[model samples]
Target chain A: MAEVRLVDVEKRYGGFLALPKQSLTIEEGEFLVLLGPSGCGKTTTMRMIAGLEEITSGDILIGGERVNDKPPKDRDIAMVFQNYGLYPHMTVQQNIAYPLKLRGVDRKAREARVRETAEKVELGALLHRRPSELSGGQRQRVALARAIVRTPKIFLMDEPLSNLDAKLRVSMRAELKHLHHELGVTTVYVTHDQMEAMTLASRVAVMREGRIVQLDTPKKIYSEPADLFVAGFIGSPSMNLVEGHITGGRFEAPGVSIPVAAAERGDVVLGIRPEDLELTTAEAPPIRGKLYALELTGEATLVTLREGATSICARGPAEFEAEIDAACALAPRPGARIHLFDKTTGQRIAA
Target chain B: MRDRSLQYVLLVPAFVIVLATTFYPLAYSLTTAFRDWDLTRSRRPEGWVGFDNFAHAFTESHFLNSLWVTTIFVVTSVALTLVIAMSLALLLRRKGRMHTFTRVVLILPFAMSPALIGVSYRFMFNPEFGVLSNGLAAIFPWLEGTAWLADPELAMAILVLTDVWHWAPYMTFMCLGGLASIPRETEEAARIDGASNIRIFFGIILPQMKGVLLVTAILKTIFALKMFDQVVTLTGGGPGTSTETLAYFIFNVGFEWYDMGYASALAWILTAIMMTISIWYVRMLLSERKMATA
Candidate 1:
């Protein structure tokens, strides 16, 4: 395995900048997940490291040797594309063995390695079948097998689980975690799925508009987002962001008021996670609004409340029941953290 | 009318045209191929000659020579066209201003009339004051006065060249369509797998292009087997009968020699060859579909 480093990398197509100058270092055997929305330059960053795309200005070093000028083949890296990229004309075994074959491995050894890789991916029976005959999940395994067949210095996976069904993606994600544990190759994985990054990454690099917005361990980043964009992005049902203000050590908006230790600012956005908010029938909770909707999600009921133009969703107990348009009080659960940010700049404000 | 009847009614004009233009001539040719008819002798056909014209074809040296020439031309031209067309297609597949312009210009070669292409090549290869001939002679002093059309091999080579130039552009478009269907990720995966550009093309891209290449080869082969316009316009059966293809020989047999019966038999043979090739093409397509499902 090898450590990968990108120094002052910049990418531009004509005059359009795809990636601004940025630097990152992925230590040996680290599974660094690049997480962002589409067109956020997450895939572009990984491709530049893989040498599949040309960096407008940068130095990419794998194992301390600059690979910026090297072609993908010479970079000693393997990539699994989102579509799997399995060769339709070849059997699964042949597809996995292609890397070893190109390196001039003999038939006897190639077959042995192919067999071992096939079995590792639970694809022994399907080795003789072409990609056309395989299901989506099975095809994804073939792509994984192809990347892991040979011992490359690094592995690049571009949303490899994105093509599989929801259930299949969960199972394959576990498989990938297991594979990385066993092989420990320095891997750069690109995906927009927060759960994948949270579960699989040693560190998550959340990107936005060609820049790394936050880079930290998943748990730390999830609990302590650097900015408003990240706090709103990382959670499901999304974090409830209410545009309010802080005046006289109290945060206030329409039908809501919260005592927070912050300087008086007319334009401030309050951020609270759904799970962190508690729905109550008390007279004056920190958040008060008319019930907009109630949705039962198996274990819990998500109570959505609206005050004027702003909507807030609070995850309440599963047994909780309420009607739409009823006045509801939502208080931050005891000791639950409330995040504040400057509304205009979207930067986190100390609270 | 009901929709079903309306569909059939709409096809009436095309059906009548096919029957009058295609089936009638086909039936007349089949009957005449078995009869003795010399247009110089009489306007009407004579008594039945039952395989006599077919037998004469096998024994006739002119017919045998034309068959040999046609085989050489078809084999050379088809192989050359496929290679050049596929290469051009690959080159043009990349997106750039120049590449787009080149792809548009590619149609010019295929769009020109075959007869006109022949006439142009003939003039271009003329030993006296021809641009290409004089240019080559100027570059190489040893080729000061070489006669390009007079030599049997050179004349046949020129015929194949003109045919390849005329057809490669059409086949190149076919190859481009095939190339587009292949996912870009597959080639990218190959590159990451340590395969060079050459290996990716031959190992990945070429294997996927099999169906398109087969179709192109069959079409070009059929076109080559019946080549006549270029031979007539360029060499006029030249210095000898060296450039005369099978279709050209059939024209000579029926028109110049007034041997209509034999010409009809030869035309039937060519049609049989084409029919057999078309059947093979269909079989290949079926197998390709089967492979896809499998």
Candidate 2:
């Protein structure tokens, strides 16, 4: 396994900067995921590392060697494309054995390794079938098998599980985690799915508009988001961001009032996770609004409340029931972390 | 029942046109192939010939020469056209101002009529005053004053060249269409799998292009077998029947020699060859599809 380093890397498409200058070091054998929405340059970064895209400026070093001049074939890296990229004319056995064949491995040994890799991916039965005969999930397994078959120094996966159905994606995600654990190969995965990043990555790099906005472990990034964007992006039923001001040591808006450690400031935004808030019946709760929408989500109910211009969502018990436009109160659960950010800059306000 | 009857009524006009244009001629020819009908000797068929007309083809020296000539022409022209079209497709697949301009210019040759192409090449390869002849003589002194369309081999070579020029661009467009359908990810994946550029093309791109190439070869073969206009306009069945292709020979037998029964039999033979190739192509394509889905 090899560690990959991008030093002051910048990508420009005819003066339109696609990726701003940035440096990142992916530790050896670590599953680092670059996560962002579309047009965020996450794929661009991975392609550059795979030697598929030319770097406008900067050096990419893999395993401590500058490989900017090396072709992809010489870079000792295997990539699983988002579309699977299986050879339609070849059988699954040939597709998985291609890298070994390219390396001039003998026929007998190549067949053995291909079988072993196919069995690992549970594809032994379908080795004779072409990609057109396989299901979407099976095709994904073939792409994965091809990459791991050769045991390249690093593996680059560009949203490999995105094409599968939701249920298959979850199972495939678990398989990928297990594969990484078993192989211990340095992998750089690029995806727009936050849940995949949280589940599969050793560290997640949240990117926005060509820059790495936050690069941290999944738990740390979840608990302490770097700014307003991370706070809103990292959570399901996303964190409620109230645009208000801190006054008299309390953050206050039209329908919300909460104590904060920050000093008095006018343009402050309050960030709180939906899971951190509990439905309360107290006379004077920290958050008071009229119930707007209630959605049952199997294990919990999503309760949204609106007061004037401020809207908030909180996770309540599955049996929680309330009428629309009725008065609703919500208070922070004990030991729930409260986040504050500067409204003008979208920067976190340390307390 | 009324709608079904109306559908049949609607198809009647098309059926009549097809019968008048296609089926009638085909049936008339099939019968004519087995009869003795010399236009100069009789207005109607003179007598039944059985397999005599078809049998006469094997014994005729000129017919055998034309058959040999056609085989050479078809094989060489189809191979040359396929290679040139595939290379042009690869070169023009990428986007650029120059490539776009070249692609637009490439259509000119294909757009020209085959007869026109024949006429132009005949003029260009004229021994004394032709521009191509003069240009080649200037580049290579030994080529000066060479009778390009007089020699048997050179005449056949020029014939093949003209056909390739006329068809290669159209076939290149077909190849480009085939290339466009292949996903770019497969090539990138191959590169990452440590396959060289050449290996990726031969292993990945060329294999995927099998269906398209086969279709192109079959089409070129059919067109080559039926090649008549160029033979007439370029060399007029050559300087002593040296480049007399089968279609030109059939024309000679019917119109020049007034041997209608023999000409019909020879035309049927050419049709049989084309039909055989087409059937083979269809079978290959079906098997390829089966393998892909298996």
Each model's DockQ score:
0.80, 0.75
Tens digit per residue, CA lDDT, model 1, A216-266: 999988888889889988989888888988888898999778888889888
Residue-wise C-alpha lDDT for candidate 2, range B126-229, written one tens digit per residue: 98889999999999999999999999999999999999999999999999999998889999999999888898899999989988888888888899989999
TM-score for each candidate, following the candidate numbering: 0.97, 0.98
Q: What is the TM-score of chain B alone in each candidate?
A: 0.94, 0.96
Tell me what TM-score chain B of candidate 1 gets against the true chain B.
0.94
Q: Write the per-residue lDDT of candidate 2 for residues A1-351, one digit (tens) a residue.
A: 999999999999887999999999999999999999999999999999999999999999999999999999899999998899999989999999999999999999999999999999999999998899999999999999999999999999999989999999999999999999999999999999999999999999999999999999999999999998888889898999999999999999998989988898899899999999999988889999999999999999999999998999999999999789999999999998999999999989998
- In model 1, which regions exceed 4 Å deviation? B1-13
| Candidate 2: segments with Cα more than 4 A from true spot | B1-7
Candidate 2: fnat, from 0 to 1? 0.84
